[model samples]
Target: MSLKRRLELLEKKANYLDSGVKIPQDFKKFNELIGLPISKIPPFKELPIFGYEMDIISNIETHRDYALNKARGIGATEIILRWILFRAVQNKIPGRKFLIVTGIRLGLARDHIKRMINLCYNIPGIIKQSSQYNITINNSEVIAIPANPAAIRGYENVEVIFADEAAHWDLLDDDPVLEAIEPHRTKSNAHVIVVSTPNGRRGFFAKIFHNSESKYYKDVKPWIISEGLLIDRVEVEKVQKEDYYRFEQEYNCQFLTVRYAAFPPEVLAILQSNSMEYQLSD
Candidate 1:
């Protein structure tokens, strides 16, 4: 603890006693004021964050849309949930809705978010409740949904949206989902962050990272990433020699061509020649 944090918490005590209700004005200090690093929260035992990781989190505070490409087991969900909590507690609007989309069930998403909910206990007048994968923190409502067009397409008035494990999304190429997700974003300039490990060489996740300069995209580089997951360097070295592609993209955080074509060259050549053409002669 630093002198600055001591002063901040002292001020919080005065403010809390006056009204018995306080909404933190500066979310940048929320984590510090809470007096608990993410590690001590629960489930997570430790977090070794780099300086770049701190900078990226600051950048995300103001960006309208952002994406993070991280290696496996690199704790992308923890960073994202922290950002969402900042947005939720800082915003004044009720019905300030949020969405968390995941590759499958909401287990992991639920876990990270539950940690955020625990921190709310320290903040006075903050109302929170949880049922399954849905949580209400202060005035914001967060609902975790599967990553599919049907789940994403119909939502409206969303203030922020997060796509977790985006590379594994089933409706990756579905235009309708994009159509819906894209519209509200433009209306409110909603914040969107997509976090994932590299999977295939194609689809929405791939497109966002590869085309970062596109008008609506803000590509966020992974700050906490290493050259590779050197769990046991000798063993990892042997494994990488046998499966280099997975090692690079899955553990090393490089989004290369780890995936292969669904159709082989022989089949693709046949389709190319036929052109799937249809002609009618009367």
Candidate 2:
């Protein structure tokens, strides 16, 4: 069947299933309806929903903006990707869009878009058009762009924005990429989801994660050997032996002091706090 005809049938089926009621807003329901593909684990074709994954999904559903400081290899990225797909499928308005801003490398952005296309290909009738950087479903679309100010601007009607590996974005005294996204997000009242492992004690990710007053709903997940699912105890031991700091920052989600900084993180924090207080008093 042609893509259009298949979409028409799918729409009819969806309408029949809902019986004129609003489409279900539950993520788990849609997840079960359209099973997620899992290529990492052999003999398992579908992604399993562990309690951790469910917790993250629940937070995403509840909060308009979320920041996740996740351990490496824990499937945080996978969950966000599936969430974007869920949003795209459930969207009822035309020209509603989703944007994914990946790390410094352009290749990372393309890879994310490719994964979205692959997911759409697995489930028929879900994709209307796809290219190297974007995929269209019905009237809604998902686009992946590089993590730069110029690349992020000019998109409108964005329903959700994902900053993938956000800690690694090339930032200066001010975060231009995040600054660029704010206008689009504010104009559309869009949800912004930032996911990344810790890089250092600085950058936009760290600032948002540590700021208690920020609007972002923040959570951190560490590698728990007792879980014995995503990362194993043996590998953790190896990385710990090689570089304990790397192990702590990467798997344990600790924002440690920079290796060669002139001042300790605590000292800098105190100085910054004092500066702010002085300004307020003056």
Candidate 3:
């Protein structure tokens, strides 16, 4: 049978075992191998203080690939990273791995990993101790790898791919890091999440955001915040009247071109969401 078909069988057998029906003694071991209850797994909601639209997470849960480019302070990285951790731990499939790739140094990478580790450690019933936080409930690995092309090419069978700070990578050079991981997602249920704040002008992220197939192009869940969000409209006009063009376009989520002008006032209205209603204490 194909790997996909075999996995389906294992899933079916696991469900039957969960229902407490009597299977043959020989099949007991197989059930133990595959069955992973949610209560015994780590809860991902414990990480980071994110305040984004519900529709954003809904899109991620439904469609696996997302290319999100937005202004800073939108909580893009934290939201996606938390989602990755949540999915990895909640469904404890053996050999499952989630890789977080970044253009920053290894130390910075560990900072994010450490946040995830602490979240897992603090949650009481969700995740039991399993070799610290580097490994998950059923030995599923949540790893952070640097953006070097050579290092990324070695991994296989990764379930989720998160490319953070994507604007830092050069799109013209064939993007070996993306090339290596894209093919490994042969499973129909794989997820690829790319997120970044605006950086200068051109890059791999810019191309992806422009493509029609990209989630951004389709307007899955756009929450564009610019100077208008932070400062009063008339106040901004007075502070940088001559350079208002620069401040509005760069700090705001505006796409600058020679002929076309700033976003119509109506488009910004369509993209913006209300301030996040935080439930972190819950």
Each prediction's whole-model lDDT (CA): 0.65, 0.78, 0.55
Model 1: what TM-score?
A: 0.72
Ranking by lDDT: 2, 1, 3
lDDT of 3 at 68: 63
Better of 1 and 2 by lDDT: 2
> Which residues of candidate 3, in runs, are more than 4 Å off?
1-51, 125-137, 169-174, 213-250, 255-282
Task: Tell me the alpha-carbon RMSD of every candidate.
Answer: 5.6, 6.2, 16.1
List the candidates' TM-scores in order. 0.72, 0.81, 0.59
In angstroms, the error of model 1 at 64 is 1.3
Model 2 TM-score, all chains together: 0.81
lDDT of 1 by residue, 184-229 (tens): 6787677777677787667677777677475444544432333332
State the displacement of the C-alpha of residue 79, model 2, in Å, after optimal TM-score superposition.
0.9
**Which candidate has the top score in lDDT?**
2
Per-residue lDDT value at 177 in model 3: 65
In model 2, where do residues sit more than 4 Å from their true spots?
1-26, 37-45, 262-282
